[model samples]
Target chain A: MSIRDTLKDIVDNVEGALAAMIMAYDGIPIDEITVPQSGFDLQSLSVEYATVLKEIKRAAELVKAGAMEEVSITTNQTRVALRVLNEDLFTVLIMTRDGNFGKGRYLLRLKGYDLARELA
Target chain B: MSIRDTLKDIVDNVEGALAAMIMAYDGIPIDEITVPQSGFDLQSLSVEYATVLKEIKRAAELVKAGAMEEVSITTNQTRVALRVLNEDLFTVLIMTRDGNFGKGRYLLRLKGYDLARELA
Candidate 1:
């Protein structure tokens, strides 16, 4: 399907997932989908995280670890799973802390490939 | 147990575990241990990652996501798992790409408390 459909599929399928978005390493969002009343600014979070992810990708390369494929962050109130779509793009999922994080992770990987292909 | 002993314990118990360390958000290493032939500079990696971790913790707070409890990055050659012991300090486990990452994550949480206690 389309990029938005893929993003929507990820958010809709995962329990407690508030939003999903495709973002560039340079802090630009290509597209996003959020549930109504989700009540969180996921785009801002993604932009802030992109800066850190860029550094992380560089660090991984500097150490010869090769390309960073995934990075997940867990907090007391939420869980974020980010999967690299390619060198310049990535997908992020935002879920509640008590959400089905494992399932969210699984969906990110499953749909991340779909989103990547659509982008390509 | 001594902090060094606990750090060493984490590295020893997990397959493909190359190094472990306790570090502050400010980038100072509290304690660390590494295998003799790890052939990787884990210290530099940790130091570089600390900056990103600090930013992540802040972003989580800014989003009202609460404290950032853990972060994991996977690359082609290595996996790095970090667990926050407290606001200022966190534990890091570095393993080869094929390492037992689940075990490393568990040990970081299990022994992270021990190290936190030692520090407290």
Candidate 2:
């Protein structure tokens, strides 16, 4: 399936209460199909959010001579952030409060691996 | 110069009061030289830290159809987290409380790009 199609599956499966957004690691919105909308600052966040990924990539270089996987940020603000690296790409999602935070993360990761390989 | 050497220069420059550490995004410590060593959990944290990077890589894929840059995370705990991607590497630094959070980050990025190229 195409990448968009895969993303659709993610958002659809999440259903209502779960807001699905594909952001540019920089926090720029890629494509998100949901209601109630997300009021996050994707444009600015996209750039700032990237800092976390950049550092993680650095760690990977040293250990294993370069073999790193995923990284995340958890705040008391009811938001859980995860960053997955695929080549030179970054995929980020901001799960709404009602979103199945744990399940959503698991699914996204599964799909992420597939997407990464597809791109490769 | 080896990546380690470059890092040593960074720690030395940062000097006293600034605690320097090179940790895997997973929170695992790579190597850190300082008088008062940091007492953070590297083993468990390493795996968790990687999550942030993974989600970011996902974001990059969706936007620009696959072009992404650095990602960062900032906590009010006097600790600023940065992720600089270098090809297949991940470099993460937990800057000391007194470290030039901004400058340390800048140098890391410049060095990150160079290191990425070197590894490649």
Candidate 3:
């Protein structure tokens, strides 16, 4: 299966998931899948979030905390998870506030590797 | 107890804990505690992280995701958790990569309210 397909599987299986995409640390999208009426601009959101994630990734290294593996952000209306696939790439899953958060994380972990392999 | 004492209690109770602090989104610390030989500058780390976190908080709002409640970052040698206390204040916990992350998170939830109440 392709990267896009894997992302689709992730969004389809997770309740309330609106979008999933592979993004670069520099705010570029590699591949993405979004359901209609996601109610937000996934690309722009990913870009904004990438900038912050880059800062965090650098901070973790500066502190000798080792390479960042994952980041989870929970807001009142959304829960987003980003899992590092490589030094320059990470997979992001955007879900509703009431989405199955645990399952989203699990899918990210399980399928992120497939995305990473395709990139490699 | 004072905010400092509360921070101290959190660090002392959690295994491998390095530091805990209450910081504003603008990078000013309200209160903090760090054990000897923490091996890193907690203030500088928090300051840098605060900047990134502020961006994230704003992005969440911009996307209408509602107010960000929590963020967790995991790396090779350390794990950092941030819990929002209010619009201006948030609590941070830093621990070793192998620290009792679960307990650390629980403590933050239980004691963060105390810090928030004291601020009010």
Candidate 4:
């Protein structure tokens, strides 16, 4: 399947998932999927979240904490999870406030490797 | 109680919690405590984790996501949870690999307000 298809598969498979995107380190999305009913701007959200991944990686490197593996943010409205796919890419998943964080994180981590390999 | 005592209280009350700190946004720990057996560096870890919080906050602002409520990063070895206490400060908690993430997060969120109030 293509990158966009893969991203769509993730959103479709995970309940409560509103959007998914494969983005570069520079805050650019290679492909993305958003549930229209969710009313979220995937493009802007991806760009904003990319800044988060970049900064965390930078901080981890500076402190010798090794590479950042995964980051999950829980807000009152939604849950955002990020997993570093490789040096230049990462994936973002936005889920509903009641979404299953553990499941969302697990699925993302499991699929991240495959996604990276496919894109490579 | 004092900030140090407050931090220590968090570590003591939360099951599997290894360490806790109240730190500035610049990565300086105002008060912190680590379980002697945990052998984790609160100073460096706090500093490193501070970078994660700062970066996330910046990214959130850029994306118009409003103030970051909480951030959680889970690695094979530990789980780090961060909550913004104020404009210039935040809190960090470190737990074991098998730590209770849901509980840890809840406790941090609950105590964050009280801690912030006391510090203020």
Between candidates 1 and 4, the one scoring higher on TM-score is 1
Per-residue lDDT value at A35 in model 1: 88
lDDT score at residue A69, model 2, on the 0-100 scale: 45
Q: Report each candidate's C-alpha RMSD, comma-separated, in the order given.
A: 1.6, 14.0, 1.9, 2.6
Q: Under CAPRI classification, how is model 2 graded?
A: incorrect
Put down candidate 4 lDDT per residue, B23-87, tens digits, no spaces. 99887888878888776656677777877787777777665555578898765467788887887
- Model 1 residue runs over 4 Å out of place are none
What CAPRI class is candidate 3? medium
lDDT of each: 0.86, 0.53, 0.88, 0.81
* Candidate 1 residue A71 C-alpha distance from true site, Å: 0.7
Of the two candidates 1 and 3, the one with more favorable DockQ, higher being better, is 1
**Candidate 3: where are CA atoms >4 Å away?**
none
lDDT of 2 by residue, A7-117 (tens): 667767763323444555444556554434455555655666566566555644433223444444433222344545454666665555445655666677788877677
- Alpha-carbon shift of residue A8 in model 2 (angstroms): 31
DockQ of 2: 0.05
For model 3, the chain A TM-score is: 0.96
State, as a TM-score between 0 and 1, how close model 4 is to the true structure. 0.85
Better of 3 and 4 by DockQ: 3
Tens-digit lDDT string for candidate 2 (B37-113): 45544554455556656655554443322333444443323344545454344666555445565576667667776
Candidate 2 segments exceeding 4 Å error? A1-120, B15-36, B63-66
Interface C-alpha RMSD after superposing true interface residues, each candidate, one decimal? 1.2, 11.8, 1.2, 2.3
Please tell me which model should have the higher lDDT, number 3 or number 4: 3
Cα misplacement distance, residue A103 of candidate 1 (Å): 2.0
Between 1 and 3, whose TM-score is larger? 1
Least accurate 10 contiguous residues by lDDT in model 3 chain A = A57-66
